[model samples]
Target: MISQATIDTVFETARVEEVIGDFVHLKRAGSNFKGLSPFSDERSPSFMVSPAKGIWKDFSSGKGGNSVAFLMEHSHFTYPEAIRFLAKKYNIEIEETEQSDEDKLNTDVRESMYLVSEFAKKYFHDILLNSEEGKAIGLSYFKERGFTSDTIKKFSLGYSPETWDAFTKEALGKGYKMEFLESTGLTIAREDRPFDRFKSRVMFPIQSMSGRVLGFGGRILTNDKKSAKYLNSPESDIYHKSKVLYGIFQAKQSIAKLNNCFLVEGYTDVIQFNQAGIENVVASSGTALTPDQIRLINRLTKNITVLFDGDAAGLRASVRGIDLILEEGMNVKVCAFPDGEDPDSFARKTSYDDLVAYLDTNAKDFIQFKASLLMNDAKNDPVKKADLIRDMVTSISKIPDRIQREIYIQECSRIMDISEQVLTSTLAQLVQKDITEVGKKVKQDQKAFEVVKNESPVQGAKVDVLYRLERKIIEILLLYGNKTEEFEDVFLKTNEDGEIENVIERKEYKVYQRVYLSLQEDEVELANPLFRDIFNDLIQYFLQNENLEIEKYLMHLNSDFAQEVTDILMEDERVVLHNWEGQNIIPKTKSETIGQYVSETILTMRWYLVDKIIDELKNSVSNEPGSDNTESMSMAMDYYKLINSFSKKLGRVMSRYS
Candidate 1:
């Protein structure tokens, strides 16, 4: 268990924007920060962070909370893990009770795999730095590649021994479970014997955005005829090759700061670029680029420059990657090294200044590079050139912006010496064809989901009205609970003529007190479980403290309650009242008439509850034709009158049935 002092220190030291910004590229939006939602694929930004309240909300995924909560949601860290991450990031020393070895066995499966992977990384790295065999083999290999000791340790380059079962024996001897070892692909278990997976190899640990080791990539040292040169950890619960990008954990901050990411092919290319003073670089690890991986970079930048080897044959796959980045609405540039040179080899030989200058001069717009590369093979052949134009048009259509597409098409027309009109026409046809295909796919998907599986036709929207009203009541109490306001008290009593008439008395009470007294008068409770808990807790907070400590309250709220609070607090931010005041359509802010707003919300909730009760009473009488329901009927009539009174308070025009 982490001590309260440590958790508080972490929370105080770790700024919400700083913690989230390490992974997300944030831009100022009014007083808050906005960025693309990390939880969902989106072009427009829907994620918001408010430093004043120390909370964040992702409208796309409906997940919202403070800094620690963001870590938990984005990286799937447990609460203690999140706190520890924050502590480490903020340089705060933590005090916590260490978990016994017995407690480790009951950990989550994914966590166990993560622990094993981390241990493997440490063990291999130690061997490389300390062991004679490792120094002679793995250390020598990295040294021959021109890597310094600092560079070697920065990437955590490690060595695995030649013996098949060396790592497995050590892991088992340390009381590590074989279940996690085999599951993480660190040790391959066979019926006869368990062996190390990467024998005679150099290790590169793959990490998540928060620097947690997810897996490893090992490069074989010896040129064995049968074995592959490079081997990666198999897809496990924590590591998916398609979703993981090599060096992302190291490159994220630099990419976000520079506003561009350098895309390379292999692990060495990334390390070499970083060693050359270019830190914003990552590799696909020789796998085809994936949308998921692109999105990981997308969260940090809107620009990517692909660094290609001199081989034109390999350029085809990188061209496909360019199309993917364009489809994601990002600006892409391509640069290729001279013949017989890749980023790794070139960066190793060239000075940092020369490498930077070369990259700047060689980088070309993606569309131009693609057309010129393809044009080389299609030269002097009208038939082949025409095919090239169509292919270029298809790539252009992947662009989401019309202005950008038009610009690229004009560039393509100039480069190909073709008419602008012809390229534009071809582009339009391809775009229309894509739309038609999408429509057909949507219809097909609808047909596939035609089968109904529910036992009853329950309309979720039917109950939302009351739930919203209850939620609104909580919102009002939370925002204005400590504020004292004048409220009109209604009473039905005899007048001078001895006739029952409505009498109104105005009284001063705190917003929380009024809500509590009103609800207590008729026994009303919030319908939504989350809203109910928040409402009671918020009332208690207002009662105990004069000043609202929103951050303190947030410390105890689960993501669900925090989401509700953020939706309530930040909903007004989403409402754009742009230029409405100029047109004499000024909106009334709740702060100005908060008392009235609170009363109206409470009245609306009461009215909804009374109406539901009246309906239930009516249904009961209607279902029993032979029995008399005089008591229930009288109770429903009273409820109807109460509804009328509440409707009047809420300024709703409902005809009185009584």
Candidate 2:
């Protein structure tokens, strides 16, 4: 177990914005940073990071927390794993007890796969640097491709021996489970026995954004007719090839700093470009460009430049990729190398300065690239040219931004020597068609949601009342709990004549203290299990810590419960937090009215409870007419009168019968 002191140190040292900024491109909005939600597919910025509060909220996904929680949620790290990640990032020395054998046996499957993959990466790297066959073949091949030792090491390039089952035997000997080894595709398990899958191949370790080894891509040295040239790790729990970009773990910082991404096709292309002094480059790793991969890049940069080989296939891939990038609401530019030169070969042959200059000069907007590339094929053929025009319009229609679509249309019209009016009309037609399709999909989705809602066990105001009140109470605690406020206390005292007298006293106390005392006095607790737990935690924290770190509280919360709190806290952003001061609206701002708000919310909660009790009592009296229910009836009437008086004080109408 990690020591509490170490955990506290990690929390203190890790900055939420700094940690999240590694994966997300955050821009300052007011005192907080805002970006596209990393948890959801979104075009607009709804993800917020408050450095002052040391917390982040993704309004789209309803996930919020501090640095550690963000890491856990985004990377799917366990609590301990997240703590370790933060500790490592912040250079904090960890204090932990040695795990027993049972702990090793009970390690999670995904983490086990990660461990195996990491070990395989190290093993292969050692073989490449130290083994004779690896040096003769793998090291020689990389060196021949103009990769320096530093470059090879930076990308974790490695090699597997020619002998079958060599890696398998070593891995199994090391006590690493064969199940994980096979699952990560390092060793392929057959009916008879398991052998190395990437035999005699140079290895490229594909790492996740957080630099954990997810899988590998291996390139074969020998040109055997029967063997595939390139083999990648099969889909596993930790590695989704479609979602993993080859150089993302390396390129993330550069891409964020540059505010742009350089997209290439092959692993070598990415490595060579980084070697050539261009660091903000990644590859699709030979797969078709996927939305998941695009979203990954989108988190780091809004601008992407596709570097293509001057081959038909490369051009086709660029065309296919541009729409996906545009659909993500990103700016895309396309640049192609001279014929017979891919990015890998070109970067290797050209000087860094010359290559950079070439890319800058040759890169064209996607529209221009598409129009220019297809114009030749459509030349002097009216029919083919018209089809090309429609194709360009279709591409433009895929763009989510209206201004971008219009600008691209204008550029296409000017370049193709076509009328702006005609292009605009065609673009409108394409956009209308898209809207029609989207409308149908939305309607279908709404219908499905309605069906599900109708079938759900919990529905309507009966469910809403308890949850809304519970959530509101938590939100109050989260937002105003630490503030000192004046509260009016009401009590009963014995007068000099031995008669009961109503006594009112005003006192200043912290919001949390007042809320706690009020709830304690009334013997009330939150009904929802999650909210109740959070409420108890909040009270415990307040009692224990003199310095209340709301962010720390959120970070230490269970992931699911934290998300619910986030949803409640962020809900105000969707509505008016303060009452509008016009016509019949109150002039008090949220800060000025918070005391009243808290009081009203508490009273409303009590009123609801009282109403529920009254209903229960009435039901009891009606069911057991033979029994003596005079006391229950009197109790119900007393609750009714109490709730009515409370509601009147809050300026709310109470229907005792209803």
TM-score (C-alpha) between model 1 and the true structure: 0.85
Q: 548-626, model 2: which lDDT tens digit per residue?
A: 7766677577778777766666564432222233235544435677788888888888887888898788787755557
Clashing residue pairs for model 2: none
Task: Report backbone clashes per prediction.
Answer: 0, 0
- Candidate 1 per-residue lDDT, tens place, 73-180, comes to 999998888998999887899997778888665677887788788889999999998999999999999999999998988888899999989899999888789999
Query: Which regions of candidate 2 fall more than 4 Å away from where they truly are?
Result: 1-5, 190-193, 449-469, 479-486, 490-505, 527-529, 544-548, 551-560, 569-658
Q: Quick one: best TM-score, which candidate?
A: 1
How far off is residue 275 in model 2, in Å?
Answer: 2.0
